[model samples]
Every structure is written in structure tokens, then in C-alpha cells.
Target: MWKSGAACSATRVGVATIITTVFGMALADALIKQSSTAMTLWQIYVLRSALVLPILLVMARGRMNTGRYGWIALRSLALVLMYLGIYAAIPWLELSVVAAALYTSPLFIAGLSAIVLREPITSRHWLGILIGFAGVLLIVRPAASGFKPLALVPVGAAFLYAVAAVITRAKCSDMPTRALAVWLNLSLLVTGLAASLYLSRTGVGAGFDYPFLFGAWRPMSGRDGWVIVVLACLMIGISLGLARAYQSPRPQVIATFDYSFLIFATFWGFVFFGDIPDRLTLLGMGLIMLAGVIVLTAGTPEPTRLEKAKVARDQPLVPCRVKTRTRPQRTDTSPSNR
Candidate 1:
């Protein structure tokens, strides 16, 4: 039938979209890590977002209307926290390690969906959650010797990301994806500005460790400026790609393809940084990835486009019946699922 053919085509588009989006994201992570020694995280946040927000405004083209500014700002803050957690650990952990640890967002999403969204989570979903946590443990190896607590930072980042996704569906669902991105960049800009000011004024980072995070801004070369520009472009691309993928009729397909981020992260790590994952790390990454696939694809439904923010990027789930009202079925952007 025409419907079936159309479904398959849409699924393909979603798959391609998510794969490309995460590829750019993974590459951006590598670039940031590579540039960490040259630029502070605050500096890059200020410069990269400062460069991108104008272009995004231009692209938005006078369609900057929204009624849920408060919720949107909160969602953006959650993402900013997620961003901080992931990036702050970069100087300490390997790329693959951070990537694997951050992928734990789906498990957090699963749990949060049950608690906050009141969504239906099947037995299989619970199994996936357990497996995902096991993978996280393997990656973090808390019981092992010489363990750094920073390894758990990305795990916490995953939780923040889940909160953002939930807020997207619960409150900011009426906004546009472009607007969501613009607000996120704005928040990043504000955060960078605030952090820079505090650090400069307080002189905390003057003698403290973690120069990339809390230290004062460093001088940039022409090459460094161009690298920041490239990062901005990648951010725009990933944001738009994520929107496109999630807006496709078959968003679940898109969510499934997001797992490619693990592979891309590992590839870039090896090729660019010459960093390789040890056997346990590799196994842990595999488990985390497998858990995500299961969490996303299991107990699912045919998905549709999300509101302004799309998350839960790799899976779809159905909500349980509520006595109060009938809820329109919407897929998570990683439901609100990717």
C-alpha cells in the first residue's frame, strides 16, 4: 500500500537524520576535547554560542514567537547542565568513556518517564534499564582501584538530559524546534558570561586546578578562532538534524540510529586523539549501547513529531491511560524519547 511505502521512506529519512546528527555531535565533542588545552570551556561556550546565535536568529527569520518562555528557559538550563557535566569530564576521561557514560541518558529517561510522565513502561523496559545500569557500572567500575569520581559526572549529565527531555514534552511542547535551539544557545551564552565574570571577579580559577573549566579565558590564535567557528556550525547542524529526524513520521527509526554515536565517538577517538578503549571499556560501551537499543525499541509505538524540543532520541513509548483526560500520542524525541 502507499501508506506502507511512505512509512518505509520516512523511516529511512529519520535513520539518516539521527545518524548524521550524532556524527556531528560526536565530532564536536572530539574537537572540543582537542581544543581544551588551547581554550577554556567558558571561552568556547561564549564564543561558539555567540557566533551561532546570530545566525540562528537570522535563520529563524522573525518567527521568534513563543508563549512558554519560562519552561523553555528551564529546559535550556537542564541541557546546559548536561553539557557542563559531559564537557567538564573531558579533561579527565577518554572520549569513548565519556560517550558511553553519557549514553546512560536513556535509562534515566526510562525511569523519569515512569515517574514524571506517567508513561507505560513494560517489563522488557525494566530489563533494559537494569542492563543499562550494569553497563554503566562496568564502565565506571566503582569498586575497582584508582577510580576517579569524575567518571560519574557524565552519568549525572545523563540525568539532567532526561529532565530536559521531560520538560520538553510536559511544558514546552508547543514551541518550535528552532526556537528551542535558540534558547539553548542563549542559555549557554548567559552561563558562559556569568561563569567568566564570576571567575574573573573572584579570582577563584587564578590558582585553582581545572583551568579548562574554572580558569580565566585564554588567548586564541587564528586557528583557534576557526575551530570555534567550526564548532558553531556543527552545533547548528546537529540541532537542525535532530529536529528533522524527530519530525519525520518514523522517529523511532531515528532513535535507533542514534546508537551510531558510540561508534563515531570511538572512531574519532582513535583517529584524532589516538585514544583506544580497553577491553572492559569496549565491553561496557557495547552493553550501554545494547541497553539503549533495547530501551528505545522495546514496548514502542509508531511515533510522530515532538514539540519544540525532541529527546529520547532513540526510542518511542506509549503512555498509560489516565482517568482525567485523553492524551494524544507523541513519540519521545530520543517521546519527548531520544
Candidate 2:
């Protein structure tokens, strides 16, 4: 009874942690979008990490996963590209649109895992894939009179993120999670420095309107600096919170609440930018969420009658594994799946 009570408590904690983490993530997205005029993408990448990387380093103990550095770099590059797509679209797309589009990542992971990992996918998983894309089409609205190209950016980002997930599973499965995060932040820092250098040297975006992407380094106001600090906090908060949440005995519960980011994104969008997703966008979000749940449960097996009989006769505990397209899987339970 005590064990069951503890499990219930742990589940509650996981649920709360995941929801809180995603809320912070959504707020970070909204903040980044709001601060676009003040801070460029590269600047935020550099400055934000400059602040948070130190603490993450202390936590990770400066481990580099040296043996798998090549694979780690590849994964980090994929994720950096994914973030670039996500943040670049923020200035142009609605927050909810970006969230929903990026949330299509589960579908991409499902498809990619089948192709790359050679994992057998269940029929329900395929149905999930189809339903997820249907949601994408509704959100993208390619045939509509007012389709925007930026709407596709998050979808592309989602695919890139899926690629990173596949790499982590196939190659970096043994790397410590915090250590991997260290490299990711380091990659972001290096990329930011390189881009800032090139832009500053060539004046490539001189007098252009894409201040968020192309603008060179500019002096930071106090408010701008604080935004950077807040964004960094959000980044670290998300990482730590996810780590804590997934550590819960009830990962299935944590996984279900993970989609709360979409709702939180929509909420922050409404509050910060007065951005409201229309009916189709909301529908797309719902389909994507439902598809994710279906995909998450796709490969879980029901115990056979013999196993059930044994359980009843002996009253023995049974163990089961649930697979997510790239979400942890049977042996891997890294939070980076999303």
C-alpha cells in the first residue's frame, strides 16, 4: 500500500513538472518573439547560453562524451537547426501555429524510426501518422488563399528534431543526458559566434528588415538584457524540469502531459501577442495531440491469456514496455525524444 501511495505521489509530481516545464517553454517562445526587435537570434543564442551554460556545466561536470563526439556533434547540429527554424518563424507565425507545427514531430519520428531504425511499426502507428499529417495540412492550409510559407518552417524543424532523436537512439543512447545538453548549448554558442562574426564582417543584412535573423550585434538595453536572462532561465528550467518529470515512475503520465506545451503556447500567444488560432488551427492541434497519444500507445502489447493466468495464480508482478515513435522506447528513456 505504501508503494502504491508513493507511486501515485510520483505520478502527480511528474504531471505537475511536465506541465510547468512546457509552460515555461511557451513563455520563452513568446518572450523571444516579443524581443525579436531588440535581440537577434544569434545574439540570444550566444548571450543566453553564456549565462546558463556555466550552471549546466557544473551540473554535467564538463563531460563531453569524447568517444562519441562525432555523433554528438551531428545530433547537436540537427537540434541547432531545429531551433533556428523554430525561433526564426516566431517573428512571423502565430505562437500556436508554431507549437502545433513543431508538435507534428511525433509523426516525423514515427516515420523516420520505421525507415532508419528498421523498427516494425504497428497499423495504429500508421494511422497516427496519417492523422497527424492531416492536421498539418489543415494548419498549413496550402490550398487556402492566404497560406504563408513560414507556416511550414516548424514542420521542417520537427523533421530535423526527429533526425536528432534517431541519432540519439542509434548512437548516443549511452551518453549522459546533461552531458548531451552541454554539447547542444556549446553548439548553439559556437554557431551564434560564427554567424555573428560573418554578419558583422560582411554587413550582409545592412538596412534589412529581418532584424531577428540578419541583424548584427547591437548594444543591449537593460530590458533587453533582462529578457535574455529570463529566456536563459526558461531554457534551464525546461531542461531540469523535464529531467525531473521523466524520472518519475509514471513516465506514461509525464508523456501524456507533455503535449500541454501546445495549450500553454496558445495561452501565451493570446496573452502576449493577441494571437488567436482560428477554428482550423485548433482542430489541427487536437488531431495532432490525439495522434500523439495513439502513437505513444501503438506498440504496447496486451498480455496473453497464459500470462494473465500465471499472474492470477501466483499473484506475481508483470512488467511491460511502451514504445513511442522516438520517445524513449523499450530501453531508452531520454527526455530529448520531443
Candidate 3:
């Protein structure tokens, strides 16, 4: 049993981690939206990435995983594109609408797991999947009159983010968290640098670039610049907290808390962007949450302790592997020996 103090600390960390993750992400999105007005999406990514890279570098010393570095780099690159897509859409999309659209990622995970993890999906799972898709359609409202061509941005982003999550779960499970964090920041840095350079050449210098990055790193600016700097730092902290949360807690539990992001997003949308979600948006969000809960609870139970021990003893834990290998080899070798 955990001591009282330890338990309290754990609870605090869990709550703080969730709150920070949600709030920081919302603020970052808002900042990117605000920055997008004055700067290109690439410039915002570069500045935000530049703000976090040095700190990640210092922390990753002695923790880097050379063997798994490639996967880490790939994951980070995917994230760069993911954020670029999400943030770029912000200038044209409602904050609540974008948040609702991205939340459809869990549905993709549920579907992808059938192929990638070989898990048996049940009938209820299908119901949840359909419900989730309906929710996305409601949020997107393509049939409505006001739909713009760029409204599909969030859908495209959701697909890429889903793929990124699957890759993180399957391929990068063993990657060191610190090393993964470092690689993410580094990859963002490279993308940001290239983007900043392009914006400079295209004569978008102040209009599409940060007013300061063109030689003068800090010029006369309003509080907005400071807000961006602070929000960028908070984004790093929240991301680190999320990495730790995923590392420590059982994934199901952490995933449940991830639902809190929707709540926080709505709250921040109102507070920062004056986005008051309509009844339809609330209903759609509720359905999406229901789908995620269904998926989480439907996960297959892990084997019992006895079954685990049996597998550890090198016994035939699953009969299919034995039959496949033994019968094939016996038929081929039996003829040769005879």
C-alpha cells in the first residue's frame, strides 16, 4: 500500500499532469491561432520548437537511445506535420469545431487495432465506431451551407495523428521517454528552421515571420510575444508531464483522463477565443466520449498470473504457433528422412 504522503503526491501529480496537459495544449493552440494571423504556420512551429529544443537537449544527455533513434525521429517528424496541419486550420476554423474534429482520432485507433494488434473487435465496438463517425459528421457538417473547402483540414489532421499514435504504441513502446522528447524537439527545430527560411525568402518576413527573428530577436512588441514565449514553455512542461503520465500510469487510466482535454478545450475556447459551442457541438462531443469509453472498457483482459508463468516456462502457450511450425516441418522433413 502506498503511504499517505506518497498517495497524495501521486494523486496531485496525476491531476496536475492532466490539468497542465489540457490547459497547456489549449493555450498553445490558441497562441498558434493568434500567431497565425500575423505569421505563417511554419513560423509559429519554428518559434515554438526553437523555444523547447534547448531544454530537451540538456535533459536528454546520457538518456538517448541510439538504436531506436530512427523511430523517434520519424514520430517527431509526423508530429511536426500533425501540428502544422492542426494549427494551419485554426485561422479558418472555429476553435470548438477543430477540437471536436481532432477528437475523432480514438475511433481510428479502435479500427486500426483490429489489423495491427490482431484483437477481436465485437459488435458493440462496431456500434461505437459508427456512432463516433456520426459524431464527426455532425461536427464537420459538410452538408451545411457555410462549409468551406478548407474545412477538411481537421479530418486530414485526425488521420495523420491517428497513424502517429499507432506508431508510438506499437513501434516506439520501448523508446526512452527522455530520448523521445529530445528527438521530437530536434525534429521540430529542423522543420521550423526550413520553414522560417522559406518565409524570409518569400517576403513574408514580418507579416509571415515573427517580427523579431529577422535579425532583431527582440524588438518593441506588445504582450503577445511574451504570451507566446510563456505558452511555449508551458507546452514543453505539459508535454513532459504527459510523457511521464503515460510512462507511469496504466494506459487505460491515462487515456480516460485524456477525455478531460475536451472539457478543457471547451473552457479555453470560451475564455480565450469567445467560442461558445452550440448544442449540436456538445451532443457530438458527448457521443465521441461515449465511443472512447466503450473502446477502453472493451479491451481484452490480460492473462492471469498462472498463464503468464506457464508461458515463461517455455511451454506451448498458444497452440496455433506450435501446429503451424511442427506440422509443416514434419511433412517436409519426414519425406527427406524416409
Candidate 4:
């Protein structure tokens, strides 16, 4: 009874943590969208990463997994690319649209699992993937009057994010969550520094005036600086929340709540940017969320052959009895004594 109660409490904590994670991520994106108007993406990345590093370092102390450094680096690079794509698209696209597009990662994950992880892909997963892509089409509205090539940016981000997630599960599953967070932020810092150097040397073109993507570094306003600080804090919260949520014994339970990020993203979009989704956009968002929920709640993956072997090896051995001709001799002896 006590064990059951503890499990229930842990589940509740995991759910709450995941919900908070969604909100924190949405808020961070909103803050980035707001601040991007005044600062370069590289600058924001560099500053926020720099600010968040010390905190993650302290948290990750004694938790680092050096054995999986290669996988960690791969995952971090994928994450950096994901961020670069989404941040570039955010300025040109509506917040909700970018978010909905990015949320397609679950579909990508499903497909990738089949290819890379050798996980069976059920028909339901395929249906979910189709519906999810249909949602992307609705959002992108390709060849329609409202189509924008920039809409593809978030899709790219989603693909990279899916790759990162797959690597997390497949290669770095044993690594501590704090170690993953530390390496992710560190990678962001390195990417930011590299981008800043390249941009500083090349200079911004006249046609690309958006400081967030193309513009070179300049003095950040006090307001923008504060916003970056808030963004950094939000990133920390997001990292911790996601790490905890996914690391839970029953990750599917926590993952089902991840779709709420779209809701929060939509809310923040309207409140901060005064951007409202039209019927088509809303439809797309709904379909994407539904597909994500379906995919996440379908079922957990079965243990791999290696994992099954490991489980079997860890189990205690039981002694076996042998029946032999001696049993008959003992019975005969007992009968004579009687």
C-alpha cells in the first residue's frame, strides 16, 4: 500500500513537472521572439548560454558521463541546429505556426524509431504520421496564396530535434539527465560563439535587416538584456523539467502532457505578439496535437534483445530438483521398513 501511494505521488510529480516544462519552453520562445527584434540570434544564444552554464555545471557536478561523450556531442549538435532553424523562422512566422510545425517531431521520431531503433511501427503510428504531415501541409498551405517558404524552417528544426531525441534514447539513455543538460548548453555556447565570429567578419547585408538572424552584434538594450536573462532562466527550467519527465520510469505518462506546449504557445502568441491563428492554422494545430497525443500514448517500446538478456542475467537463479532411479529404491526401502 505504501509503495502504491509513493508511485502515485511520483506520477503526479512527473505530470506537474512536464506541464511546467511545456509552459517554460513556450515562455522562453515567446521571450526570444520579443527580444529578437533588438538582438542577433547569435548574441542571444551566446548570452543566454553563458548565463545558464554555471548553473548547469553546478547541478551536473559528479553526474557527468564521460563514456557517452560522443553521443552527447551528436545530440547537442542536432539540438543546436534545431534551435538555429526555429529561431530563424520565429521572426518571420507566427509563434503558433512555428510551434505547431516544430511539434511534428513526434512524427519524425516515430519514423526514425522504425529505421534506427528497429522498433516496430504499427499502422496506427503510420496513420498518426500521415495526419501529422497533413497538418503541416495545412499550416504551410503549399502553392496556395498564403504559402511561405520560411514555413519549412520549423519543419527542419523538428527533424533535427527528432534526431536528437533518438540519439538521447538510443545512445545516451544511461547518461545522467544533468550531464545531458550540461552538454546541450555547452554546445549552444560553442555554436553561438562560432556564429558571432563568422557574422562579425562578414558583416550584415543591406537586404537582411533583421538583427536577430543576419545583423552583426550591437549594444543590447536594457530591456532586451533583461529578457535574455529571463529566457536563460526559462531554458534552465525547461531542461530540468524535460530531463525529469523523460527520465521517469513511465515516460509515456509524462509525454502525453507534452502536447500542452501548443496550447501554451498559442496563448503566449496571442498575449505577446497579438497574433491570432486563423481557422486553417487552428485546424492544423489541432491535427498536430491530436497526432502527437496518439503517438505518445500508443504504447511504450518493448525491451531490446540486449535489454532482455540483461534482465535475465540480473535475476536470481533458482535451484532445480532432479528425479532419478534412486527414488524407486527409496520407495522400496520405505515399504520394507513399514
Error of 3 at 293 (Å): 1.6
Pitting candidate 1 against candidate 2, the one with the higher lDDT is 2
Tens digits of per-residue lDDT for model 2 on 1-338? 99999999999989999999999999999999998888899999999989889989998884654577889989999999999999999999999999999988878888898899977688899899999989999999999999999899999999999999899889987777888888889999999999999999999888687988999887899999889999898888887898789889977668778999999999999999998899999999999999888887787456679978886999756787787676554866689863
Per-model C-alpha lDDT, please?
0.88, 0.90, 0.71, 0.87
User: In what order do the candidates fall by lDDT, top score first?
Assistant: 2, 1, 4, 3
RMSD in order of candidates? 14.9, 15.3, 11.0, 5.0
Ranking by TM-score: 4, 1, 2, 3
- RMSD, candidate 2, Å: 15.3
Candidate 3 C-alpha RMSD relative to the actual structure: 11.0
How does residue 59 of candidate 4 score in lDDT? 88
Off by over 4 Å in 2: 300-338
